[model samples]
Target: MSKCPRCFVSLTSDHFAWTQASGTTTEADPVASAYHGGQVLSRKIVELRRPVDAHAGWAPPPQHAELELGGPVREVCPTCHYVLVDGWRNAQVTCIAMAGARATGKTVYIAVLIKQLQLLGESWGAVVEPFDSTTEATYRDHYETPLYEARGILEATPAAHTGNPYQREPLIFSLGHWNNVSQILVIRDVAGEDLENPENARAPWLQFFAHADGVLFMFDPLKVESVTNQLHDLVPTQERVGGDPRTVLRTVLGIIGLGTPNLAIILSKFDALQSLQSVEGSDWSRIMSNPGAAFSRDFSLRSAPYHDGDGQLLNQEVRSLLKKLDATPMVMSVDQPHTGRPLPNRYFAVSALGESPVGDRLHASGITPFRCLDPVRWVLATRSVWHWQ
Candidate 1:
């Protein structure tokens, strides 16, 4: 069975459910509201569970028990009540949850990642597109427009508890097909405010992190005082920043508990660090100046098999760079998770926008992403998807 595109929960055969696709009988649904972290007024939602006395292959009818209900009914996840996409069961899903503190450029990374993904797919005779209207509209209105059209930084993603948040749903995309199985990619963006406090770990909505295919844990280089001091002259003052990332990672890891998911520890806004290459006499300059280093340049010319040789090099290089930036604790947290269940992991460095925005506008040179695909490709490579083996 495939998983729910929104919540990342496996669509188990034990329970089946459907909700009225569209109905005038909207009411506050406490079950849906509880999973959403806010009130969710839903249509007539219905569910069924297997009876203990039923045979091994016993199954409920394709539709809800109340047959004469509505014009159309759609399947909904029994756990989170998110409407399932058509053919959700037959397709393979790659669900990734985005984790980061405030001002970590999570939105910006997503805005650019989609574009890069499209271009990469086009080169390899594949198509990547929004799976549903929700994805297309959300990407266009929330992610694509502000950055590509307006050429400005995206607003911080509002918390789920906020009124009518569009971010409550995952960004689902169809990645053509790999190995002849339709591949779906779902990205869940968690507001930094939601994950900032450890107490939020107890919230039911956070269960997705425990079940996601992978978690992209973004770490802002500028968060470190020493690094910020060095780049003071290069980039403008950051308007907003969040609490300690170490605390946020702990909260995320805590929520995951014993669940294991590939963890992509990303160094976000790496252009700030790349700028240090011009510092002439500093250690950062020398480190960033190594032309042969995997962090020095992008290998965008090739389609993967994920380039594991280079990936390994980049992993080691990023681990070393994190230590230099005084973020060893964050690395150790993932390496030796408090849950005592260490997830398969990798370290990555990416600059969604090639240069820091001189205030609200993107760099004058234009958006030249640096290895933004590393994390996503790493996840996809595991599935033997677009990166054909």
Candidate 2:
């Protein structure tokens, strides 16, 4: 069964609702109104009865005889009332939620990740495009223009309650049809401020994490004072830093509760750590200098599919690196989670900008992503959509 992009809730035959696009507008849908923070005009929401037999078919059950049928109708999630995309029920979706403290490079990672996904799709003779107009406009205005065209860092993603919280909408992309089904990718970026505070953990809007397919929780190395202190002399100091990662991780787990989404503990701003290879006599320098280490190179651009051997090596390397950065508590919690529902977890490191930004401006070297596709590929691979060659 496919899941709603906004709510991440499963859409079974028993749970289906829809609205017709007649020339009349009624009261706004409560869920849609809250999500978009505005009125969503449409006909009254009509709940469909579940089919009597399991083997009947996938189409919605016959509409009520009394309902007026004039124009096209759009299927919507019965729970959230958000309109489902055309042919969504027949499509396969991979829903991923982005979690991290402020300045962990979530916004920048997304901008670079989409471009890289397009390139990856080309390798498989497929096309990747935004699934909807909202995704395209949001990506272009909020994420792409500032970072790529203006050559500056993107403004922090606003919290859901803030005025103009564009992050509330999921960025949906169509990856063409694979395996006789339309493959879609849905990504939801959460503001760090929301995850850092305990109060927001219980907010109704934050419930999507409970059903997400994968949660990419980023841990910023730059947030660690020791790492920053070491790089003070070598690289320009980053002005913005997030709260304690341990606290943020705890908050994320609290929100997740018992959900079984795959957890990816990502180390963001890895370029800063990579720069430590030049710090003479330092243990980091020695560790990063190893020519054979998987973390030292990125082979994602190669024609071969994602290498499990390389990913496993990098996972071990990053797990140990997290320990070196004093993230032992976070690692221990993932192994023995407080929620008592252990999730399939992995360690990943990415450098979206390829180099540290000088203040608000990007590095002169331009954007060079490292291992940005690993997490998503891992999720898709499990479904047999994309696999290692």
Candidate 3:
């Protein structure tokens, strides 16, 4: 069974529901309000009966006769009321939830990650495109435009309850059809402020984390006072910094509960740390300058499949780096999670912008993403979408 992109609930034919597109209005929908933050148009949900034995074939049950004479019916998620995209039920979706504290570069990473996915898809003989119009428009206006066209830092993602919260809708990308199955990638970006505040932890929308295929939890190394102090002279000061990452990580794990999502603890804004190479006589300088370090070079752009040897090397290297950055508690939490469930995890480092931003503007050198695709590739590889060849 496929899952709803928005709510991550399994989509089974037995509990199918839909609405007539013609009657959808601006009136509030109770189900949508619960998850979307407000009253959306009320979609008349038509729950269909489960089909009987074999030879009944693909036709809907007789009770829901309107479906047979469908004029403009739209299939929606039975739980969240989100309209399912065309062929969504048949597609293979890889759902990922983005987590991080404020200014951890989640938005920036998403912007760069999509572009990288497109390039990667080309190499794999696939054409990646938005699965729906909403995803297409949202990606262009909120993500692609601000970073690529305007050349400015994206504004912080608004919380789910905020009016006009663009992220309430998942960014669904279709990675063409592979092996007779349509491969889809669904990404949901969470607001850092919401995650930091314990008050928002019980929100219904957050339940998706428990069901997600993977979670990319980013932490900005520059947020550490020690790291910031070291880079004070080398890089421009950031306009906004987020809360302590440990606090946010705790909140994320709490939300996950017993769900077994593969966690990728990503070190964001790595370019800032990479610049430590310029600091003479410092251990960091020596570490950053090491040509053989997995974190020092990006092999993502290569045509070859993801290399487990390099990934394992980088994972261990980053685990050690996190320890040195005083993220021992965060590391400990993942290593021995309090959630009472086995959490499969990997450590990754990425520089979405490749260079630190100057004020709200991007670096004049342009966006040169480094290792941004590693986490996604890791998730895909685990799902058998790709492999280390």
Candidate 4:
């Protein structure tokens, strides 16, 4: 049995109970349940104990229960009640959740990121593909179509009942195998509006962030006044929008509490910064055009498989960049908080769109993602899957 990527619940056969009906016969079996009870557990606390009659070294799950299935039974996550199928656990799963204010380029990132990952996975002898039917349909209809095929900016995600909330489901991917073990990646994208409104998070559904392996907190560079002003001539500037990053970050921290997960504070829509190179005489131009700078170069082409040092170097560069953007206070909020506790965090920059939207159309340069894989790579690196080059 393996753990659910979202809530870290031990996903064993026993926790699941389901029912199936064939003709006039109805069968039931154990499927899954919500993560109830207040008892907190670590990876070792709930060990899989096998039945006495089972094979040697096999262990039975403690939360084992039976399901009275009215139809075909399926496995599911005990934490979020998300269902899963066989062979889902035979991998090093990494779960990431996205948080930001609305129009932070998350939907575009998802569509383009998938294509980029597919390109990168080829070099590692891995094929990146959607894990389930839901992901395939959703990714194609909602995310992939408008962005990739139609070449337009994705519309704002509708509210839940509005029927077009782009994030109604998690994006699950199978990244082939890594070092004899399969690598499964699950990403949960939340509406920026949801994260912006902390008062609404009292519900139990929002609690999953507390257990995520990593949370991508997108800080839209376009939201920064100075940057927007400087780039107004080079790119189209829309009305100042999005809730304060500080507010959203604090809410995310509050939801997760003290759980140890990588917090990636990302400077999103970085391609606009890249365009600042045209400013010619300005300091921003020099910084933006510096070929040797971490942000200027795409390290994804490096021959080393996974170099922690390379990623850390980029982190330092981005930290300074964020300071330049006047996000220092937000950094402090993550480091030395007024609450006296800080999350294990890192700073990153990614340009999912690679350029600002020209009205409803994407810039002709096409989507060139920068450091987009950094956050996900860091989380997986923590599991010791690809720690060293």
Candidate 5:
């Protein structure tokens, strides 16, 4: 048995739809035998383990539609032709879609997030790697090289179908094996510009959000005046780029159109807030000074390993933090449904670069991510997948 990458359903040899090579049905290969425990698994085991059918060619019965909270199937995977929806997969992929106005650190966060995950995965004895040539090439040119190698913020991700469409490619990581089964993680990064552009909402490229397992909605705190005003004395003022977060967020939810993916509302570029702790006579100065608080701590350099308890506590703290930042309404809209359906939601704060760069160049410390793994780990834990020892 194998699983659908889009929806973690087990595909048995009997049930897997096969297309004949050379366009001859007689020449089609039998479904590949999958290893289970020790002996090969039966087709019954695969069918019984199937999670949900949300791929392009598969259709869920009418009862499933009602259980899915009246959400719409927004897109089909161009490669697998999988119709993307909630409960599509049993393996549980953490699909965190990046969304914000331009230059809100969406690209930078992605660059850092991957490195952070690579480090975190090591503790579980899993070696994360790109699933294919497409994943490797896209991650290198768009994400890995510019930040990790050249030590600069990544150039804005090019739009889909342009000279560069790497962000559109999924970055897949192998999570070793668990319970005699191998686990894989797939992450997709999207351009903030595409999310912000009103015209792009209806465009095909933006359709991924509707099928994502999770979305990390980034809100830049630098866009707030009170925070920026206080920062001038300590840190140089940043050039304001990007549209209003509220506007972009609303458009994103609209584009998703009632799809029930877990929403991870994130505060990006949190280094500026960290800087406030040392400043005198400021409200933010006192807030960040609390040594016992989760935000005051750094997991990148600390002994803490990623998991649920601490993560859930941090999630609550971040939601409260966002509320204080006056982003409660935006958070509520994604979580508190007007149509009487509540979506699974979490909140996170991340600093892609430990410190802000003077211009396009990175700070001397390079990129040290903070709380970058929260969204992905939360999604993974939900599936109870474990890396091999």
Candidate 6:
């Protein structure tokens, strides 16, 4: 069964609600507002359910919305009230949620991830594109333009309560077909302010992370006092530094509760750490220059499959690196989650820009992503989908 792309909730064929598809005035919908964490204004809603002991098989009265109260109707999720896309019921959906503190390079990573996915899709003879109009427009305006075209830094994602926030909708992409079934990828981005507040924990709105197919928690190396002190003269000054990643991680884990989503603790902007190799005579230099370490190489683009051997190597290497970076508390939280049921998790390192920006502009060299796809592919491989040929 496919899940609702917006809410990541499992969909059922049993019964669903529908609203006029056209010529209807939008009004406040409390049910959707609850799931959205804000006021959701939409068309009037109507529900249809199968009668008990109806028959061996049952279907909606009509696939089309001719029996509409005001106009043609479309199906919606009974839980979140999200509209179901055409042929959505036939596809398999994978939901991924992005979580991290502010300035963690998440927006930069996303801008590059789509392009990489499209390039990979072409090589494998698979069609990959935005699944909906909102995704197309949002990606182009907010994500694609600033980083790729303007060659500048992206601003912090606006809070969810702000006017016209783009992150409210999920970025859904059609990954063509895999395993003889339609493959849909849904990525949801959240504002760091919301999660960093701590007050937001245990709130119903963040339930998406708990229910996600995978939740990626990104840690910023720049936030580490030791890393910053060592590289202060080597790298450009950071304009904005987010709150402690540990606090945000705890809040996110609190939201995830006991839900067993695969957690990927990604080390973002790892190029900054790699630059430590030049800090001669330091412990980081010796560690980063190991030559045999998995972090020393980039095999993400070359490999068609997500090899477990390589992934586990990188995972262990990152775990050790985190300890050195003073992130032991972050590691222990995942290793022994207070939820009592420790979730399946792995560590990954990704350099979205490959090089730090020179002020607001990108480095003179063109953008290059280092192992940005590793975390995503790790999640996909678990679902047995999109093993590139």
Tens digit of per-residue lDDT, candidate 2, span 266-372: 99888999999999999999998999999888877664667777888989999999999999999998998887768888899888888988988998999988888
Task: Report the number of the highest-lDDT candidate.
Answer: 6
Stronger candidate by TM-score (1 vs 5): 1
The ten-residue window of minimal lDDT in model 3 covers 60-69
Clashing pairs for predicted structure model 1, backbone only:
none
TM-score of each: 0.94, 0.94, 0.93, 0.84, 0.75, 0.95
CA shift at 291, candidate 1, in angstroms?
Answer: 1.1
Per-model root-mean-square deviation over C-alphas? 2.0, 2.1, 2.4, 5.8, 10.4, 1.8
Tens-digit lDDT string for candidate 1 (1-389)? 37886668888879877888776888898878777777878887778899889898887865454584555888888988887866788898989999998789888899899999898888877799999998999999999999999988888888887865777888999889877889888998888988898999888888889899889999999898988888898887787888789989999998888877789999999999999888879998999989999998787536656787888899999999999988999889888877676899999999999888888787799899999998989988886767756
What clash pairs does model 3 have?
Answer: none
What ordering of candidates by lDDT runs from best to worst? 6, 1, 3, 2, 4, 5
Comparing 1 with 6 on TM-score, the higher-scoring candidate is 6
Error of 6 at 185 (Å): 0.7
Q: By TM-score, rank the candidates, best first.
A: 6, 1, 2, 3, 4, 5
Q: How high a TM-score does candidate 1 get?
A: 0.94
Q: State candidate 3's TM-score.
A: 0.93
lDDT of 6 by residue, 287-316 (tens): 988999999888777537987798999999
> Candidate 3 — which residues are off by over 4 angstroms?
24-27, 49-72
Name the candidate that leads on TM-score.
6
Q: Global lDDT of each model?
A: 0.86, 0.84, 0.85, 0.70, 0.63, 0.87
